[model samples]
Target: MSLNPIPNQIILLLLESYNLGANINLAILMSLIWNDLFLLFLSVRNIIVFFGPSPTLTKPLRL
Candidate 1:
């Protein structure tokens, strides 16, 4: 199994933020944070869409 691309991008962004260190500008950091949150929300939404809601007691069907 492989990690998703969007999560990978977020990790890179976070690493860049760490590299920015004390010299980091507030606006850029804020923007990056917002982008990360958006990506996370999107990933969760995608998972829900792909998996659908949890199963109930419905009988399993044979193909």
Candidate 2:
């Protein structure tokens, strides 16, 4: 399996931010953003894997 770099970078950045100061709100926001980005990346990867070359097409059904 291939590695995903974005999630790793997000985690590293979050750790760095946490170490900076007691910015609870910023930390939470960073975590949320990281979570959303990771989830989105995973979902897109799943879709691509599920539908290889000739992906199924359905106007109303989107991934």
Candidate 3:
């Protein structure tokens, strides 16, 4: 098993949004954006988590 939680989070988010009465078009758009954002977030998080500290530190980051 992988350590990443992105896939599960995305699935839950999609399901929750659907349950909240999002239309097909809106759901599709939201899912696409959500998936992209989650992927970006996970990649950056993995880079920092696996690589440790670097010289690029300038300010605190938020997810």
TM-score of each: 0.46, 0.47, 0.45
Query: Higher TM-score: candidate 1 or 3?
Result: 1
The collision pairs in model 3 are none
Compose the digit string of candidate 3's lDDT tens values, residues 1-63: 786799889998999888776677778999999999999999999999898878558557867
lDDT of 1 by residue, 1-63 (tens): 987999989999998888777346767788899999999999999998898866653457668
Model 2 agreement with the true structure over 1-63: per-residue lDDT tens digits: 977999999998998887776577779899999999999999999998887644345345657
Off by over 4 Å in 3: 1-22, 54-63
Query: After TM-score superposition, what is the CA distance of residue 13 in candidate 1 from its true location, in Å?
Result: 33
Best by TM-score: 2
Off by over 4 Å in 2: 1-22, 53-63
Q: Which 10-residue span in candidate 1 carries the lowest summed lDDT?
A: 53-62
- RMSD of every candidate to native, in Å, equals 17.5, 18.3, 19.3
**What lDDT score goes with residue 5 in model 3?**
90
Residue clash pairs of candidate 1 = none
* Cα lDDT listed for each candidate: 0.83, 0.84, 0.87
Could you tell me how far off, in angstroms, the CA of residue 3 lies in candidate 3 after the best superposition?
Answer: 62
